[model samples]
Target: MTFPTIPPMHRDLDFNGPLSDERAARLIHSLGPLKGHHVVDLGCGWAELLLRTLATEPEATGFGIDLGEENIRHGRAGAEARGLADQVELEVGDAGAWKGEASDVVFNVGATHVWGGDPVVHTENALTALADLTRPGGRVLFGECFWKRPPTAEEITAMAVIPRDQYRPMPDLVDFALSHGFRLYSLSEATVDEWDTFENGNAWGLEDWIRDNPDSPDFDEVVRLTDAHRRLRLYGRDVLGFAYLTLLRV
Candidate 1:
């Protein structure tokens, strides 16, 4: 199906860091055998994880859904380049509402807004939605941000632009999963270095684009993204933390 082209400014503004290739590999490997299984990735940017998993598990078939047509285009190309286009499908759609057959493994990384704008509701609804998409005993991997430590009122105020309520301490997340009847199979937190790499990678991409298209009208917007990236890097390093939790339906 055809999807609307994302505006340059909107695309630049949505530049959140993604998991590194190495980390994606590790996370995929941790999900156990995938041969002949069906996998789905909601909000699958570039479909890196989905495509990587398909490459390793030759017999597996999968779908990668995201709202960005550009991302889906790139992802479709990546799958074809890997000779996986026949097995993996990439589409531009809403991750929250795209219904498919029950999958063996489902993933939603750093895109909780698919469920709702509120973090708490996002966490709850996203989990429920993923569970609905998974077959009995299937696994799900959810990546989200959390408060690294208690933040002072001023610190919270400084980061007020972000929805603070969406993040809770690590313990609360684990407890939430347990309450939902999912067995926490594995949890991986991003190291300082990994976080740095992701954030810097986004900034570098924007910088490179700006350099290549100096005459483009979007230059100012790209510069604004760079400035915001700088603030996120400087202010969010210690306060914001990210983790990938692998949960099995019990």
Candidate 2:
């Protein structure tokens, strides 16, 4: 017997991070006008923000690359539905290996792992990559996770595979961006409300799926996965923080 596999939890979210429509709008607004400019989104899951930017500036062209083919497919459909098919390109590729021309605006939200290896090391490497990827005085909207406060050992255990020292504090993160030759234009952290919404959305989506496919063979595994993720989020919701940095390559 053949049973369909369960989809990833992120499939339910509009953006793959703790971002709301208002926050996204603010981030886009900070990029200023984008008419006739080139924008690139690395590790952009479905490129929701990228598509919205192009819709606002119809003359701008954009490209998004992600490792997930399903995400790329969704992005392509979104672009078509939004009447941006002619101005946007979505591809399933390695973000770290991208060698395209420097972009006028760059987005690297919650995807710094594209650089690979140690989380701390890769963070700096990702910043360096974005520096080279963006033209001088160009904007790079970088979103990353940071430690709100030191987590207890139990809290770290609840996080499963994530390392205790995987992320730096918010101030250190800003310092890293500054050290990378990026002038910070705006800095904001995801609010508790946004975090709750993001965490609940993922669990709700999985629960909905379970209800829709009660008899599926993968049900048990999906339930376990959902529980684990929910537990982890609940434990680390306060200790972990996500920062959105609007930076300009200097």
Candidate 3:
């Protein structure tokens, strides 16, 4: 199903994830000293994390790669506005194929599709790629969804858009990280409020877009997406959870 184009205002927002700016800042702070280091962000939507890292670590430089043209454009503008144009580079490209410069930190948030469409393959491949790009003792922060509770078969069927095997329990994810030769430094899970904010924000944006473009040909698509977002929020809120895991390369 075709999704509605995100509103321009939404594109200007610094973040497009479940975590709020405060939570994102906390995660950045947890990365230890970034000063004088080089960082890479794969699938860096709008480069929120990259920009934040640059702002926090004035001596650090960063590269952000994303497939979305608008995200790249907005991220570049944001870097310039923050006087970080010299310190950061934003490129429009596939994160999977972009073997980033060997850097101190590598971040991939909510874009596991780089590895492949299959969720299990995507997670494993992404972890491997992140580890390869990070220098020894460097850090990789990966964000993904997991099962919050034991989902019933009916619930799993309802969320069939995502492969059932892809959503592992939290312990299994930790084990997967350990098996990949990385130490789990820390992890931050999104709160229910954060999830609600993300979902409602998307629905609100679509509602505004639909209202403003009532005669547009994409009206039906927008409506469909708006409905789907609401349903997912209502039904999956209890079963689905998101987390940002900080893995230290061994």
Candidate 4:
């Protein structure tokens, strides 16, 4: 079946994840002094946080790489709008293979697949990459999904057909990071309200489109897909959790 072309996620979302402005501010503040430091964001969709970091630290330069051309363009536009175009490089490239000077701050939020691994090993692979990319004493902001609680069989099936084994518990997530040669600095989980906003933002574009284009060819299919997505998200919202870990490279 042909799917409707919906609005882009960046238009509605800021960080492309369940991140609130308050939490984002705290995370940026936790990075300490970034003066004269280089920051890198891998698989950065629109690089909103990266731009924010650069905006906060005028002396810091940033490099953001993502595979999505549209996202890169959006990021570049944001940089220009924020008067940060000269200090940051927002480009479309293979983040996993891109190498550069070790950075003082590295971000791999919600994009572990950039490092190439199976679901079970994705976090580990991303940690390894982050360790290599970050200088000693640098901070890495890692965001990923974890199981808030064990899901029932029906709930698991409703969660986009994803298997329960795809994510570990929160404790295991911390242990996994520590095992990869890092010291945990701070950890926080996305609140239910944040999750609700993110999920709703994900669908609002399509919902608006469906409402405005009732006579369009893809209107019915768009509505159907959006409804299915809402149902699945509701089922998984309580069971799935997203964690943000700030780790110092050892």
TM-score of each: 0.86, 0.92, 0.92, 0.92
> After superposition, which runs of candidate 1 have C-alpha atoms over 4 Å from their true positions?
1-18, 209-222
Per lDDT, what order, best first? 4, 2, 3, 1
Backbone clashes (count) for model 3: 0
Candidate 2 lDDT (Cα, whole model)?
0.88
By lDDT, the better pick of 1 and 4 is 4
| Candidate 3 structure quality by residue, lDDT tens digits, 203-231 | 66678888898998888877876676676
TM-score of 1: 0.86
How many clashes show up in model 4?
0
Q: How close is candidate 3 to the true structure, as a TM-score?
A: 0.92
lDDT of 4: 0.89
- How would you encode candidate 2's per-residue C-alpha lDDT over 14-72 as one tens digit per residue? 87789998999999999988999999999998899999888899899999999988788
For model 4, how does the per-residue alpha-carbon lDDT over 1-250 read when each residue is reduced to its tens digit? 6666678988788979999999999999878899999999999999999999999989999999999888999999899998999999988999989888788999999999887867767777898888888999999999999998999888977766566777889999999888888999999999999998898889888888987899998777778778888877989888899999999999
lDDT of 1 by residue, 1-250 (tens): 2222223332332224446667777888878999888989999887877888888988999998999787888789878888999999999999888878878999888887887756557888877787778887888888988888876666666565666677789999777866776889899888887777666565655666767877877777767767766775677778888989998877
Ranked by lDDT, the better of candidates 2 and 3 is: 2
Error of 4 at 113 (Å): 1.9
